[model samples]
Target: MSDELTAKLDRIPDPKTGKGLQAAGRLDGVAVRNGVATIVLKVEPDEAIDRLKADIESAAREVDEVDRVQIITTLQRPAGGGRDKAAPRQASAAAPRPARQIIAVAAGKGGVGKSTVAANLAAALAKAGQRVAVLDADIHGPSIPRLFGLRDIKGLRKTDTGIEPADAHGVRVVSMGFLTKPGQPVVWRGPMIQGAIQQFLNETYWGDPDVLIIDMPPGTGDAQLAIAQTVSIDGAVIACTPQDLALDDARKAIAMFEKTHTPILGLIENMSVFLCPHCGEPSEIFGHGGTRAEAEAIGVPFLGEIPLTIELRERSDTGRPVAFDDGPVADAFARAAMAMLDSAREARKPAPEIVFSS
Candidate 1:
């Protein structure tokens, strides 16, 4: 069993360095019992984990004697680096609301239009006959309410089992702003911030929806950590622009998610281009396709680019997301959403045959 499994594991290659697993000492463990093979791999964090796992399993199963194979993969983290352990993760919601998927939209820093992208993405998904819910996890600076032009909304309401979420433009909305006074600042400690996020996630009464989009706050902070331990996140979408400053932060955001072991759906290049109204000429305002290039470098898909336009801002500010109307900006968001849908489905694909059903 050992010799056969070793031969099989050594035949595979590392996705990043193009070196065989045996050469890199990545195939750390292999055992076979009762026709089942268990293999362990210690690879770099940036390596294509899903592809590598599938490849390793396929090779092991080809051994003829092995009936089933299980691959356990762990990232090779740098020395002195460990995962953030600030917040205590809550158990899965006891109620088990029927949300098919939850995708967190995050950025390295603020002002990257992360919230706007999440809002418009949810709007686009809803327009495509998907029941969508948008949770403004940006507790400190919640723009989800303002993005949908719900300026007058004071807060959410208490309910018998859970808190009720607001409905805006046919999308479910929930934010910390609903509980605080207008313009009031949320200057709390780490525990307070985590508590707020916990309530929003576990206590909200979100009906069955096809997708639940979380508009995460900028930077990797307590909120991000809280979400990591709270529930099982389906995937993440990193939002960034073409500017170097923004990309620098975007890299940090990506690293944080990697450390947390969350699958990244892809990166969205917001403000990819700017259109001049008078001359109808396009300008590389933020630099063209920087996010696409970054995505390729990081091995994630370049979902789509959203050109900078005033109509998007105006409609978003007026409680009408551009995705609600048919146009260029709306089409861009729809394309981006479609990319996510595809990536998510592929990522969540079930193994060839399941021994147990959930």
Candidate 2:
């Protein structure tokens, strides 16, 4: 009976990785007595136990000779527990918490490719094997769904615990665009917008993702205030063109985050210059270095600059992100993502240790 139980345990697979549960070290003790089998297991602290329990039960039942199967689980230090110990405990406080990092991509005004940057950065992180999700909080014009080729997808539905997000390009996506019909304008008042934003954060089931990118609306408004009050935002990335007009609004956006106590991760200068595809020449179409100067003046990091390119506009118009293709633009966004991660790491506050006596 022990032999049969062992074989059955070998067949079960880990829910996250889809490998054998035994191979993943999910199963531990295996004992059998009088045609009954009992198994002990360890579970991931961040994962739901219902699924793990079901997997163990189904695997034990596979043994034809076993009359009954019993399972028990206790939280154990994961394999190579040193790494888990090194991670910030504040970042891992509880289950169903906000993402490990919440990055708000905001702009002083619209049309600076803020949404485009948010979508591409999320995709680039996903491509780099990081679990990512994008939340389009630009209630007036949610463009992330369109950017990820998910314009036709419907809004997420409420599950037993929370809302289940739609999947796109291996990244979970939730947006106001998914909720409203295409071409329909969101003409709701500030209170309505605030309610919607609150629902998206509180009701949505954003699984345990490494990063959650929020595409905020153009200006600092009541909707943005609602988001600030709702989530524990890790940091923010302000987007602006190099033009003076946009920089004026960009400063306000930065101030808003600072006033709300959200760390300013960095500033991204989009459309700083126009790069010619044929000649490989750069033109200062929107002027130059204004955003860098602003970053220096404000004492915030300047993440990077993105050149205005035809491919960027065309790809966004066609519902495919430029980051999906290999080029200078993709490289720029990749670097920006790394910079954001670095900034978040630097800003992380150590978790308070809990001491207990035996």
Candidate 3:
């Protein structure tokens, strides 16, 4: 089925080279599942992206088994070796920085609840009267849309200006989840991931916000490198558990940011304790203070600790983050949000340069 879909895409002509999309290297990926055909295309700035998308969608729908066609586009690098230079495409062509502070919420490994931390932080920032936007960079596991209770949003609004993100809880969000259907997996390579990040940064119409919280995919791999190299990330907030295993990965995350020259905003100790709802007593389920101690050892600021409460879990599951409501968990997240803002401001300060006689 996938091969048939690819064949259909190959027949679509690319106006630039007057060749097929596959021959021109424009068809990035093709997949067929449950009668739905998904096509990912690499489009250049000068190309008629909408026209090409429409053409592909129309062509794919001709297949008897394909009941629906979904098309996704990524920013294609200019021909003749332009990947390195492509990082600044958005900064040079797009309006300007989408927000004053572009902070990446990252973790060294998966299952660390990084997306939950990012969602609450964005909510807390918005609650504090700052305009916030979230970019879910975890293309394979995009949870921001569900975290914000935006699963109903099927697609983004594409205008002559750019793609408009979905709004929720007074915060704007952009995620790969919004493009693909539920339960659909994103099977892409490094270059494809890089292109998607570039497109989200450059082509999205994110009205000037105070902060853009990027929920990065776990690990120090291609996605992380793509984000670090593509734009001037003001700072990165590392999320880790209280266990030694999680801390080990967190250290690697910090090291990656340092190596990339992106500032370490701070570290967050998530699931620090479990507060029993019935007894109102605190239990160090994951063992407490490990992250704080690790932060002290590494000389990085320890933002704060987020407790594991029944309420916190319920709110997150229901798409209503605890950060918006007044509670202990909300207070903790607020404190972290403020600390992140401070770190971002400090990061923006220009380093003092010394001049010497030569």
Candidate 4:
């Protein structure tokens, strides 16, 4: 059966070298099983590598027994490549500092407390003595400035190297809200949005930090794809409420990540329950436990849950995330942040500097 799969691969030619992937020594290995195959391609990262991957997957699916295919891109270290002896990078005479792991806090829609989660997560990580930075990728509606209490401060400024992000509560932040007046909306096309996201990543003067959290825009849209293409994301945390609508959309979002081959760190159930102010009893205002069940169904970890309460809302509105105040909300965010750290660590891999975009 393995020989049959190899024969199928032999029929498909590599776009660059114009030889079979296996024969050309680019096919690292293949794992074929009951209707699922993971094709690992080992080659020098390049522009057309995405197309090559697609071609390889197409050939693998030709086997009548295979139903789904996954591809893991890996480093093809050149001859004599190692920490002690490596080739010079083309971008600079001196080697650039190694980048820290970047995690994107994403959601299926707006109003899911995504910004609040993102802001509090950054604060919690920072409080734990880790340097952190956040990029508000929600271009259409930037909320980091207000959440971090930097709305009054100047937005991004041009530095000699690139642009400078705002500082708040021990975390560096960059957002379109800082660029424009409060309540102003960003009206732009897809390409413009893509460019803005790229600039935030490649052009920001982000000194080496412990963790970089990107508050991805609501829903699976251009910003998500832009991030996937811009950098090698270490992991993504999908935020969702306990409502049925949110769970349905979250499933779709999970499918999107799966299709793109991005690792899902875990699922966070935000606003899991509403604490009654008077009776102090937990109420299922927006339903309850749906997100945890969804996470289990999808085979991802159920990171943690945050209850809906007035204190959490008030702190976020005042640009003082409960994470700084150290309350119930703070505890919730801290727990989720630590889980995210664990997930990122588990999913860590050696990625190349150049991304292969289609």
Q: Give all TM-scores, in the order shown.
A: 0.73, 0.70, 0.88, 0.70
Best by TM-score: 3
Between candidates 1 and 3, the TM-score winner: 3
lDDT of 1 by residue, 171-227 (tens): 988898776667877655565566567668777888878999999999998889878
lDDT against the true structure, per candidate, is 0.82, 0.80, 0.86, 0.78
Worst 10 residues of 1 by lDDT: 86-95
Q: Distance from true position, residue 13, model 4, in Å? A: 41
Q: Taking the tens digit of each residue's C-alpha lDDT, what string does model 4 give over 1-358? A: 5567778887778776778878876665565665656566665644457677777788888888888775544445576755321111232223232248788888888889888888988999998899999999999998988899888865568788777888898888888787665675665555446556766777788888888999989887767776665676777899999999998888887877775667899999999998877787998889899999999998898889998998888888889778877667788888999998998877775675997899
- For each candidate, how many residue pairs have backbone atoms clashing (under 3 Å)? 3, 0, 0, 0
lDDT winner among the candidates? 3
TM-score (C-alpha) between model 1 and the true structure: 0.73
Kindly indicate the candidate among 1 and 3 with the higher lDDT. Answer: 3
Candidate 3, 65-166: lDDT as tens digits: 998886667657656764653232234545467778899999999988899999999999999999999999998999998889998898788898898999
Sequence-dependent TM-score of model 3: 0.88
In model 3, pairs of residues that clash are none
Error of 2 at 29 (Å): 57
lDDT (10s digit) by residue, model 2, range 204-276: 7888899999999999887777677567789999998998999999998988887788899999999878999
Ranking by TM-score: 3, 1, 2, 4
Residue 173 in model 4: shift from native, Å? 0.2
